[model samples]
Target: MTVSVLICDDSNIARKQLKKALPEQWKESALLVNNGEEALEALQMGNFDLLFLDLTMPVMDGFQVLAAIKEQGIQVKTIVVSADLQIEARNKVAADGAIDFIRKPVSASALLDVLNTHGLL
Candidate 1:
């Protein structure tokens, strides 16, 4: 099965970096969005296997997105990608149903690690 992924971040550079770091097979199926609001819209329209989300963003943040996903019962698995490395933020995302969290600046290995741990790679 082709695993579709949605990458949501405010920084264009960050989005590009994440997309580039994805496995070659997954890159073809990856979708990029600028923020959580856009991520939600995309989620509503398509079924994505994974979500690479940024914590701080304009319009809507990753925390809000995670809460919305849980409240609305969205099925995609989420891995938060954030510059914030605080324990509180990590715990919040974890509590909100994110499978994993990656601290920024993200590396190819980090992406691979999260994917592998979650059996998405």
Candidate 2:
């Protein structure tokens, strides 16, 4: 089965790094967005299977995106990839339905482990 993927971050560098960290097959195909609003828009139309999101952004933030996903019952699996490592942020994302929270500058090994742990790969 094809696993559609989305990566959302305000920084161009972050987006490129995330794209690289994704499973090789998905790296070139994953959709990249600059913020939460764009992510949601793409998700609604793309029927994406996975989302790698950022917490701090100039446009809509990841928390708002997560809330909207829960409110609208969006079916995508979200994994928050951010520099926000506060315990509160972690707990909040979990309660909001994110399968996992990955710290920023995400390594390929960590991303792989999380995806593997959840059987996304």
Candidate 3:
């Protein structure tokens, strides 16, 4: 299915890999950014349906992104994709407005499951 996706990760490989894990159309249309600042800038342009966010980065972190999205009242689905699997981290993102969380090196099946659960697939 077609979906507008914004992928924020510091690692170039991780960003591209995450894009590839999405549905074909989503993969084709995904936008990649290196940090939360870039992600926020992209989001402010307001054309994306979903955001795949990483927790740690050089400029701003995923938590900051979530907070800014909330503070700004941006309307978009967000899923935190991070290596940090700490319960606190997950709970924090959820509280900050993430719809879901996916571990790093995400499998296509896992990504697909979130999409299906949220009716994004």
Over 7-115, each residue of candidate 2 has an lDDT whose tens digit, in order, gives 9999999999988888778876789999999998997777889999999997799999999999989999999999999999999999999999999999999999999
Error of 3 at 47 (Å): 1.4
**Candidate 3 to truth, TM:** 0.97
Candidate 1 lDDT over 54-105, as tens digits, reads 9999999999999999999999999999999999999999999999999888
Q: Across residues 62-120, which tens digit of lDDT does each residue of candidate 3 receive?
A: 99999999999998999999999999999999999999999999999999999899888
Candidate 3 — what's its lDDT?
0.92
**In model 3, which residue pairs have backbone atoms overlapping below 3 Å?**
none
Query: Which residue pairs show collisions in model 2?
Result: none
Candidate 2 root-mean-square deviation in Å: 0.9
> Looking at model 2, which ten-residue stretch has the lowest summed lDDT?
20-29
Score every model by TM-score: 0.97, 0.96, 0.97
In model 1, the runs with Cα more than 4 Å from the true position are: none
Q: Quick one: best lDDT, which candidate? A: 1
Cα lDDT of all candidates, in order?
Answer: 0.93, 0.91, 0.92
